[model samples]
Target: MPTAVPVAALDPTDPDAGAVAHYGDPAREQRLLDNAAGLVDRSHRGVLAIPGADRLGWLHSLTTQHLSDLAPMTGSELLVLSPHGHVEHHAVLTDDGDATWLDTGDAPGLLTFLERMRFLMRVEPAEVSADWALLSIVGPQTDEALIALGVGPLLPPDLLAVPDAKFATGSVPPRPTAVYSAAALQFGGWARRMPYGADLLVPRPAVPDVVEAAGVPLAGVWAFEAMRVAARRPRAGFETDHKTLPAEVGWTAPAVHLEKGCYRGQETIARVHHLGRPPRKLALLHLDGIATDELPARHTPVMLEGGERPVGFVGTAVRHYELGMIALAVVKQNLTPDSVLRVGLSTAAMDPEH
Candidate 1:
């Protein structure tokens, strides 16, 4: 994919792929969380555009999230699972009335699966990441900020699942009214994001115009990941293993529609939530014992303190501006939060809320 024009001016020698990790500011996290005008180059993220008459219903039958009657400009998430319920694909999508855009970390893999599943559907899935660039500005005032530039106020997904008064098994609940909408511009559009921000989708050539006019602090992935990890947001590669169930990482609360009809891996999801506990659970680890900046990496073994056997592994690790050294970890479902845990050699405590 061609680099976004906004950050294409970055020094090629600076690593972290093409996204401008930081511009000499270690306090990037603080500035962003404080609602500083922020610009993040998320060009590395992938996008797939599916435009066809049958897009909505066709997708509704394949993923975990509900979309059979998804309203225009509303955003929601979905997951493609193995027949056994392993999370094979995850994407946050938005419907622009005409086409549905699937934004994900692994677009090629998602695209391949979609192509195969399009056997007789009217949907045509194509990678649009190259044609479009993704950017985000996270904060309370993000809506007004994007409006000034004429991009979006992308509608955020319903974070808290509210059941209908008369809801029952296999019933579709009433769709909630959207409080936000993406701005339509000749160059591109914007979509509200979950947990905390708005996503900007624009053609590559329009990148410089948006970034220059954004007039906000330019942050890197470091700050974004810090916030995400702090919020206990479970990402695909980080928190999901081949056997991961939606219930394991709290995704079911936000991403799974319990009443949605059968789809791939629905059996496993149903069986796990109502019949049995997931084999593992997601947790936040506070590495209070760490004495240095050096932290454990992804896939690092996590064990009960003073125990030799491994129970789980660390996912995303970050040293928050206020929380100090912390990491999101996946551990045995039976593990107690009060129990001491070890991430590598550092002793830590688990927060079971995740």
Candidate 2:
């Protein structure tokens, strides 16, 4: 998904490298959420397809979601945790009745694990990202914007649990790789958590067609990330470390099914949830001290204002249209919601709303 648009490379090693930072006015791009839709290039995200009769059952047993009775055309989320309960892989999925499609950013490791665990199952996991790309239209106008593009109506929002049409549905299955206009965008998507938004999965070749006809502002990875942070969503690699548990990031509800039979990391999740507390918790921090255009670097140590040691590590930070400057960080679980912290030169405080 190469773009001819202006590039906003934070650095050569930025995860969002080769992405558009903004289309002229970065502020205007951020404002898309106020009342309009903003387009984001998420093509770099991985896409996996598991097609077979046993796909659902196999997934049900291997992961956190109870997929055995998953319904077709519904979107859900799943987690592959380490045997000790550490979060391993997370993906938002949809069943189109023919094959289950996974839209995730937790890559190579996720694919490797799925491949190795398929010993005798009647399922095949293949990386089809080269042929497919994920493009998202976020904000309140997302529905209308996508509809205008002829991508069709998106599936009612569904994410972590059974499909209730509220952006979460943990149980589901898939279908042919055809149209996504009305039936889950034809390519399939687990609706976005940012305000009101939708993900558009399209063929790699048709990206230009869709972008050109988007009829909305084209935002860079920066804007999209800002929105995600405001949404309190945790991305895998960024918000997680090797020791991260599903509950540590407020992910269990949307990514784990507590009543499910069994999976690799079930015990850790159960023990922590029922018996104790996670050592850390995900926190959204408002960095009022930061430059309006700057964000703290990834993994930057965050400190309590007068404390000597680092209390947590901040993930990616971004400037939001309304939220100002913010970032997600993993910190001591007992840290109070109103605790004031510091990120470099920025004075930070936990967001009370999230």
Please report the candidate that would top lDDT against the real structure: 1
lDDT digits (tens) for residues 160-252 of candidate 2: 332322322333333211112224443333333222476766788878777787677678766777777887788888898899998888786
- On the 0 to 100 scale, the lDDT of residue 207 in model 1 is 88
TM-score of each: 0.88, 0.85
Model 1 regions lying over 4 Å from their true place: 1-16, 34-37, 151-157, 160-180, 289-292, 352-354
- Positional deviation of 77 in candidate 1, in angstroms? 0.6
Top model by TM-score, which number? 1
Q: Write the per-residue lDDT of candidate 1 for residues 1-354, one digit (tens) a residue.
A: 222232335445422356765566646545565555576778888999999989988888888877878777777778888999889888878788989988898999999998988978898899988889888887776767667676545455455453443446745463422223455555666545554777778788998887776666667677777777888889888887778888888777667777777899998887787654778988888897455567787779998877889989898888788787889888998888798887876888887672
Report lDDT per candidate.
Answer: 0.75, 0.74
Per-residue error for 352 in candidate 2, Å, reads 1.4
What are the per-model C-alpha RMSD values against the true structure?
4.2, 5.3
Clashes of 1: 4
lDDT of 1: 0.75
